[model samples]
Target: MSLDYLQLAGTKAKGKRPQFFADSDNERLLSILMAVAGELAVTRERLDTLERLLEAKGLLSQDEIETFTPDSDQAEARGLLQQEYIARILRVVQQEKEALEEQQHCQSNNDLSEIEQELSRI
Candidate 1:
């Protein structure tokens, strides 16, 4: 069977996520920033490759690439791609937020149990 990269990327590992910093939010932010950086690096490399290939094939020049502007449809398509790219980068923050909310819910339940027990003693 062919590998499904999108599925693999979305899958969560079985074990607890490792924390590298004291604050979990900091770690999540760092993950998001790193994802952005990685995406930018890959995009830059791919763009450069495409530019080189086009120039070599006598189809386009570096000056033309620099000055080219997308029309309405192309711009709309790129806007959609940008939205998806941003969502991918922010996935870490979203996951962490959900995990934090779950933790707070569990803590609230435990606190409620303790309060009930204390009320019973009074």
Candidate 2:
């Protein structure tokens, strides 16, 4: 989602940049957003690869295969730990998704003056 906004900004920059946009512009903002988007994309891809490898190796799996079988107490603890780690990851993903959604909503509907005022309060 952040990438989407960044790509939009980049495309805008590549075309005819308006005069007002250049006025009092935060010169570093667009590049920062783009860098952030790129890093995030890389991170997401790495995470996906890690998940696939973990699945294949029966470390953190989705199906009841050669994975997390409760034979010993240590096995049960390991399974629980993996489950907790996955759950934490899911929660973080959810939070990021929600933050992206909120940012979109704010961008689309909220006025700049309103945002500025809110920021001032902060």
Per-residue lDDT value at 79 in model 1: 79
lDDT of 2 by residue, 13-116 (tens): 23443332463235334534555576668879997897789888887766544454567887876676555434333432444466689998888676876888
Candidate 2 has an lDDT of 0.56
lDDT of 1 by residue, 1-110 (tens): 11243334445558887789998779988888888999999999999899999999999998998899999999987776766677678777667677899999999999
TM-score versus the correct structure, for each prediction: 0.70, 0.32
Candidate 2 least-lDDT 10 residues = 5-14
Clash pairs detected, candidate 2: none
**Per-residue lDDT for 93 in model 1?**
67
Candidate 1 residue pairs in backbone clash = none
How displaced is residue 81 in candidate 1, in Å? Answer: 0.6
Task: Name the top TM-score candidate.
Answer: 1
